[model samples]
Target: MSRNASASTRIRVAAGAAVLITVACTASATALDRSAETRSPGTPREAAALTGSAKLYRPLGDDITFTFDAHLAAEHRMDPAKATGTFRFSHYLDGRGAWAEGRIDCLLTGGKVAVASGVITRTDLPGAQGNRVGFTVHDVGRHDRLGYSWASVGNPVETKDLPKCVSAAPFEKVKNGTGDFRVLPWDPDFLKEG
Candidate 1:
């Protein structure tokens, strides 16, 4: 073939390859997104690690209680799957499980997935926050996927059953939607009503 014709054919081949690659990546992303959405609404929508009954999580705080209405995203039979929630970060548990709260709907999917539609404080506790929490939880969730939960009680780091997240109260600085991983600490100072 002539030099110009050969060059033209090469360009066409390169364009075709690029198109194929783009299509593949788009399909993968769509599959993941759909998986996260297709699950039964009550089931978790992301993935996680943790199979034991006495499982644990980093708590948000004792000051706030939360309730969510989560819809499962299209996902695999994975644990700790990233679920989509629409709920309020209500009030304190009256030192119990909690009562009133507010709700919102946002997309909180990381390797960080939590159990939705329950009394969070009762179901989980807290964990290390910032870098450590993100890194560990991400790794663990990806590997195990659909084994654990994403909820907290108060100060999971304060609990004695598990190890400390760090020397400092890791989340004492970055407030809201962040924490370290640790078992839920039952409050000795917790009071209740009759």
Candidate 2:
């Protein structure tokens, strides 16, 4: 074949391969986007890692008391076959006006429920003051997705029965903490109650 004819044929082949590759990539991307959109609204969104703040509440008659703020770190589970990933947290339990700090290390199950065990240290008391100690509680909660979370209902496991804390106190019954995991949005218009 003539040199010009040969060169033309090679260029055509290369262009066809490029077009095929572009089509394949576009199809794959569209499939992934659809899957994300189809996930249950209440289910955890697929993310590499999610970071959000949590608020614990104590039911007090008609009004709910804000307990504390907990920082949450959870790995996103996108695949159905993979086991749930680890979730870590550091929280502060409010002592009326003061507060106590705690930490949690646990893994989620099906991105639904998590039973976390953590210690609460009262560093805001009087006399022995800052030297005051606290106990650990077994917390069970549903991992929140869009705008929902679940927590222990009543009396949590104490240190005496489980020996997980230094001291225990006669505290009121804890209701539940409702929470949500959200991506920090760039648009202010997308904001909602936490």
Query: Compared with the true structure, what per-residue lDDT tens digits does model 2 show for residues 59-170?
Result: 4333322222222221223221222222222233452333334332221222332222234333242322222122222233333321111123222222313221222331
Model 2 score (lDDT): 0.34
User: Where does model 2 exceed 4 Å of error?
Assistant: 1-51, 56-98, 125-194
Number of clashing pairs per prediction, in order: 50, 1
Which parts of model 1 have CA positions greater than 4 angstroms off? 39-194
Residue 20 of model 1 has an lDDT of 99
Best by lDDT: 2
Query: Across residues 1-194, which tens digit of lDDT does each residue of candidate 1 receive?
Result: 99999999999999999999999999999997897677765555333221111112226554542223443333533322233333333234346542322121112223343322222222222332121111111213212222211224343333233221112211212123332222111111123243
